[model samples]
Target: MSGKYIIMFKDSATPEQIQKYAQDVSSNGGAVHQVYDASIKGFSASIPDAYFQQLQSSLTDSPIAVIEPDGVVTTQ
Candidate 1:
């Protein structure tokens, strides 16, 4: 039940912290697709469902702002 997701960092998150978060994702069996460091201090990755809750809990003291599922948009 793994799915693509976006991990956003807080406004005060430093570049080094962002880098560390990305590495954490990789080490946790997640695939980092893209990193948005300019306007959005965050990254897009695919994380396992089983690890989602654990990741959130582990980042309780981190700069993680939010974790959201990456969804496709449609134009009508």
Candidate 2:
């Protein structure tokens, strides 16, 4: 499933630190599809909810939240 996510890492984080976040997600069963980003806005690739929640407190800056392409929702 395609999704639009906003991932803002800790501004205080170093390049290695940020890269570690991405690696962590992939290692933890989260598949990062793409890091959709532009000059104006910043966002990360598509990862599972597990990945999103994992990088919460670690982010010294604003937390990254998945805005679109939400998790699989069942409608009955």
Candidate 3:
């Protein structure tokens, strides 16, 4: 199942973590369709659902990622 998801990484994360995420998204058959960094907390990325969980695990806190199924989408 291919789809779009918004990943909001944890603020406490290190630079290396963020870099890994950017790299992961590309190699995992996912592209960053959108990115929003209005707040210092973190940024959001539109990618694939496959990478969502990995992102969640990569965070040390309760970082959230918007998961939208194939044809489903929602805005913040």
- lDDT at 69, model 1: 89
Candidate with maximal TM-score: 1
lDDT of 2: 0.51
* Residue pairs whose backbone atoms clash in candidate 3: none
Q: Kindly list the per-residue Cα lDDT of model 1 for residues 1-76, writing each as its tens digit.
A: 6789999999999999999878877888888999998889999999877777777887778899999989898999
lDDT of 2 by residue, 1-76 (tens): 3233555543344556546666766686665555543432334566666655655544545433323443456999
**After superposition, which runs of candidate 1 have C-alpha atoms over 4 Å from their true positions?**
none
Q: Best candidate per lDDT, number?
A: 1
Q: List the residue pairs that clash in candidate 1.
A: none
Question: Which wins on TM-score, candidate 2 or candidate 3?
Answer: 3
Q: How far off is residue 48 in model 2, in Å?
A: 1.3
lDDT of each: 0.87, 0.51, 0.55
Expressed as tens digits, the lDDT of each residue in 1-76 for candidate 3 is: 4455555555565556655666677788776654545563333445555566666565554444333333455899
Summing lDDT over every window of 10 consecutive residues in candidate 3, give the lowest-scoring window: 62-71
* Sort by TM-score, top down from the best: 1, 3, 2
Q: Candidate 2, which ten residues in sequence have the lowest lDDT sum?
A: 34-43
How far is 44's C-alpha from truth in model 2 (Å)? Answer: 1.1
